[model samples]
Target: MFISISIPLADETRVRPYTIASSPEDGDLFEIVFNRVPGGAGVAWLFERKAGDEINFTGPFGAFTLERAPERELVFIAEGTAIAPIRPMLRRVFEQKPGHPVRLLYAADRVEHLLFRGEIEGHAIAHPQFQFETIIADGGQEALYARIMAEVERRWVVTDNDRMRHFYVCGIGAGVLRIRDLLRGAGYERRAVRYEQW
Candidate 1:
């Protein structure tokens, strides 16, 4: 689908790539969720959009295209609205490899603020191999207590096939880097990790 997006400014013009947050079959109009950050370029405008406002964008770009292959396991790590790319990937993966092992770990400031929780949960129920863990930064749950970098290391066991599993991570600059380092340290082959930086 093609869209023409207009924000509060002109210089930001360009059809930025964005995964349709809503299900693709849901139709032409879709939502792209984002947090308002201090001096944030794209997000600042995105968060302020009113209902029915026209925004220009062409997608689903990058190497993160949503497609499925039964041979590979999937690991999705997302922070805030970075889930954009991961969400569509999951939908496509499930459609093709219904029983493939897929895990999604999303970090958020609070449980109430988690994005697409219901969708992820439903996916997990339908596909046993699909599991989701929500890490609330301020929550007391053990899974939510540690930083994302440490958590990835603690969970994944490095093996000869570590290079085979697909890893998708997106978020703030620092968090993305830290997770990359952790993955490398955990014996994940450098070539195995795919990252999208915001």
Candidate 2:
């Protein structure tokens, strides 16, 4: 899910979208994660806001959520801040469908870029059915995509139930496209692999 925040600038309004980071189970409060981009007007306005300041926005938008395939294995692939939506999906799965097998294959240029690492690790420790893997590719997006493809090939492409798995991918356009194509080429149905490009 995401929210489009309207920021009022000197002459006009600028809108920016951010993924909702908190779980719906967290009553009354929602969280958004973002990196402070230099010279970004929307982020700059957001950063200057004080407590109790009113902000205009609209949301809970986007179809990036957990599928209703309770029997299918869940494979979530996220990179950098793209993990925002995946975090809540994982929480929902553990809360409502704990028996389903879930795997998270996350990548970033650096370890510090991996969001919610601790929480995800906690879930892995608590749920035997949950698996988490991290890939740090300092060489850039191309290297990241290569490593992710390698991991996917190792974990799912060779499995007998390869087509029975549900994949959720979110990341840069090139990376997301590469993974989606790999899955599709491996004979998985298009619907079985959902993706969002950042």
lDDT of residue 71 for candidate 1: 69
**Which pairs of residues clash in candidate 2, taking residues 3 or more apart in a chain or in different chains?**
none
Q: Model 1 misses residue 152 by how many Å?
A: 0.5
Tens digits of per-residue lDDT for model 2, 1-198: 899999999988998889989987788789988876668787888889888998899986899887453677889999998999898888888887566788999999899999999999999999898999899998977988899989887777875655878899998768789899989889888988999898
- lDDT per residue (tens digit) for residues 2-33 in model 1: 13344546675533444456667668657666
Per-model CA lDDT versus the true structure:
0.69, 0.87
Residue-level error in angstroms, candidate 1, position 186 = 3.7
